[model samples]
Target: MMEAPCKRRRGDDDEDAGDRDRLNALPDSLLREVMSHMKARQVVQTCVLARRWRNLWRSMPCLDVDQDEFTTAGVSVVYSDHEGWERFEDFMDTLLCPGNVSIALLDTLRLHASSMGEDRRASRWIRRGIKYPHAGQEPGLQRGAPSCSSWRLRRLHLSNLYLCNLLAEHVRSRCPSLEDLELESCTCEFPAIASRSLKNLVLKRCALKGFREITSPPTEEPVYQWWL
Candidate 1:
């Protein structure tokens, strides 16, 4: 009982082909580009796909976080179920925690904070995302340490969250490259809106109390629709 050499060779070749990892073979930049199109949750979940993908999401340039994703069949489980809210908060904490996301590479952050039923927690996460002296900065003032002004966040959209007065301060001092800002259905406590680099501002169905001025150079008068 002897096996044929040609058949054995063919079988070995098939196995070798199966062992090849085509997805991993692609360039990291290309893979990340493809990941940019997916939701932030899906991108983070890709870590379970393979070892190489585990840390790939840390450098993602864009993230879109929607609280609705935690819902089940058009009903928000986050507000109804305690465990669900905890899970959502945990996910947000992990995603925005220090040393988790490479802030240097982050370009855009879109947060849909509706249906969370936790305004304080959601507001904290927003602050973490746009804080000036972020956790990603170099530890001390070294010779060639990267400047704190290297923030690359260009566009920020906050939906259905409570924003404090410090938000304006953060935009003016911390985010040097922020150009577009949109706030929808948010209760803003800021007294004024001011930013040097901000070009486009949109406030939709947002509740503003004692909001007096807009310091930014006139830009279409800020598209305010359905102000609350």
Candidate 2:
């Protein structure tokens, strides 16, 4: 005798259901907090877990968008091929687009694209991170307007990207609330980086041939370790 095929238990089914729904039972604020610790792509991928998590990532306060996150499998292709750069740009655009992000709650935006020839795209993403709606209109109403009032953007970090003078100026003028800035292995042709609100600045292995002035009030001396 095969022991009557071992009847299924109702308690087992109940336990399974409870386990599946445990994450969904968490509050939205907690969920967003958890998403904030994750990479931008990992946060986006959580949408597939269930319908309740579909838009949870959009509410996250921090976005860490690095091309290296997507190049885990194809290092050489991502670093040397045009199509790889395009794919990275497209993925970043999808996350940084106004429609996909909750701009008012955003606190930090970090981008790392080691590939060359992506300066324009990097600048555009930086601009988007600093933009918000005007005062008298609904959110997302205005495009390319100063949004110091609506955003909480405090920390910005860029790595392995080229920064032009005009783009650097735009960053200084538009992101008035920026507190901490980090540039690593970047080529910046800007004459100056003057920010009234910036407190902490970090530059590592950066090319600053065009840099002439940094007008931030003296805080802790900026970390300026550059490798040739």
Candidate 3:
């Protein structure tokens, strides 16, 4: 028997019901929780799966971006010279605060992209890392600004990143709510990233060029802490 003639596919709204069905069919929210834990690129690939998985990602909470995870995910990275910093740039563009997001349970932001800051591939990630939100604000950030203010962010971490001169000045004031903090193999130039409310903090192999911030021990105390 011949198949019926093809018709135009419905818009994403039509598919949203299907997405809800898939979300409903799940035994629990485990899938959503898992998706929340993965990188933005991994989440984008999931969007191509079906309407159900597509819409589900938008509601996810946790957002984590780092060189190792991006390298593992194999996104469209353009790095052959800055060491190994190519991968994370692709994600940093998609997941910044200005991006339209209804719910963002940002718990931890970490950067652990090897110690060779001058590596051609790695340096690009550092640049993108420094230049996100302001430079790569999705072009549509103006429309997304309302949603951007409601992000439920908790922790922000940076390791092995080389902050640009301009961004380095503003990093501290931008993400002050973060509690658990760690910096390793990073360069926070003069007038460094500061926070009045940090709980557990660690710094390892950092590079400071005649600039530093005084980090007072957590008065509230932490459950666990370690540094090298």
Q: Which window of ten consecutive residues has the lowest lDDT sum in model 2?
A: 133-142
In order, what lDDT does every prediction score? 0.72, 0.70, 0.51
Best by TM-score: 1
Q: Could you tell me which residue pairs clash in candidate 1?
A: none
Model 3: ten consecutive residues of lowest lDDT: 143-152
**Higher-lDDT candidate among 2 and 3?**
2
Residue 112 in model 3: lDDT:
52
RMSD of each: 6.6, 5.1, 9.0
Residue 226 shift from truth in candidate 2, angstroms = 4.8
Q: State the TM-score for model 2.
A: 0.76
Regarding TM-score, does 1 or 3 come out ahead?
1
User: How many clashes in each structure?
Assistant: 0, 0, 15
- lDDT-best of 1 and 3: 1
